[model samples]
Target: MKTLTSLLLPLFFFAASAASAAPTANSILGASDAIRNPGGAFSVTVTLTEFQAGKQVDASTLTSYSRTQSNGQFASLVQFVLPARDAGKLMLKNGNDMWFYDPLSKASVRLSPQQRLLGQASNGDVATVNLAKDYTAVLSGEEEVQNGERQLRKAHKLALTAANPDVTYASIEMWVDAENNRPIKARFFADSSRLLKTAYYRRYQPQLGAERPTETVIIDGLDPKSVTIMRFSDYAARSIPDTWMQRDFLPRFQPE
Candidate 1:
């Protein structure tokens, strides 16, 4: 009886531990965000390319610097670097508010987070995202999604609703790899519950001491031929000044 009791006790404890370790929706989202934005301050260059009818239509590059605040929110500054005509334009995000600065006119205007930057990519898309902070996550279920090579990968699907009105999407459906917590795919939805675009995270590479997706492909739901690819590169840790987060300082701000 003593020998049987000892074996059963260990098995009972093991089952209890496994049940407690089960991940919640919010925990999964938070883990995924931490993997993407690992530190408090960082800078990366993103190249956005637009394709239509299987042909490259437009391309632009932007450098962005972001800092995470004590309140667990992020402030980012983006500067366009390519195509002379679009060069020098700046976008700044401090919390939920965002502003766009036109260097040529020296004017700063309020912008919506949903406003398109290039092709299917939105102004909000380029900014640093903390999903757990902005959205209320619910564990929808588990499913298999196709990877870049069209191979099925098991993932946990999450349905997210905006916690506040300031967010770009009214709701979002996301899939994270069950094994690594890497974001596999996402579908953005409008206020009317209409599907806006689908995004696929691919090309995992080492960046800032972590393996993360180096490329994000967004496909337009309205027009299947329209596609946007955002390539992330040149990631490095850097200090972002408080003044750069202000709209008034955008005109004088220069890319480092």
Candidate 2:
């Protein structure tokens, strides 16, 4: 009986350890998204700066309001704030469709998620969407990565595969902080599996009832000298009406 009990104890402990070590990919992705979006309607200003050869080249700013619907989807309205020529330009995202409106032309044109916005940032980057709802996540492993200060930080590495055709990136490799579930780094990939860009989340600040990354720095995958920094500020809860989410309402909509 003693011999049988010893064998069973070892097997039980091994199984328990394996179960604890393996975290479900969906749960991890969901937790990370919750930290980012927080399932509420809010407003924020994003300032994008472009750099070339380590020098500042150009910059733009935009204000956006986002709200999550009952179906777990997001609706957002974005209006360009800086750069006099582009001021009053509006972009609206309703589910998978994105539309850009120009006041001068009085036209609204459809846009693809892959289209570039400033430098490394994309039109899709401004859209408020939950990635966990769009992609299927697979826990690849965990590793230590160097932070902005060159200090080692442990993170859970995840490989995210797009479940449908509407997503911006076909596949994404992301690293989430092991303890807080904050996304530390991410690599965006094209359909052909080519690396498009790399983004690093930094300068975490309290916003919309949670601590979130206030700035995102993106680097060009092919050209290491090119960089873009997006600074987020003025986060507050706002009331976004249903009329603002419709594409046909773009001409009549007015920014508050």
* True-vs-predicted CA distance for residue 1, candidate 1, Å: 8.2
Could you tell me which residue pairs clash in candidate 1? none
Q: Against the hidden true structure, what lDDT does model 2 obtain?
A: 0.88
Regions of model 2 farther than 4 Å from truth: 1-22
Q: lDDT of each structure?
A: 0.91, 0.88
Residue by residue across 29-91, what tens digits does model 2's lDDT show?
888888777577888999999999989999999998899987797888999999988998999
Candidate 1, residue 218: the lDDT equals 96
Q: How close to the true structure is residue 18 of candidate 1, measured as C-alpha lDDT?
A: 98
- The lDDT of model 1 is 0.91
Q: For each candidate, what TM-score against the reference?
A: 0.93, 0.93
Q: How large is the C-alpha RMSD of every model relative to the true structure? A: 2.2, 1.9
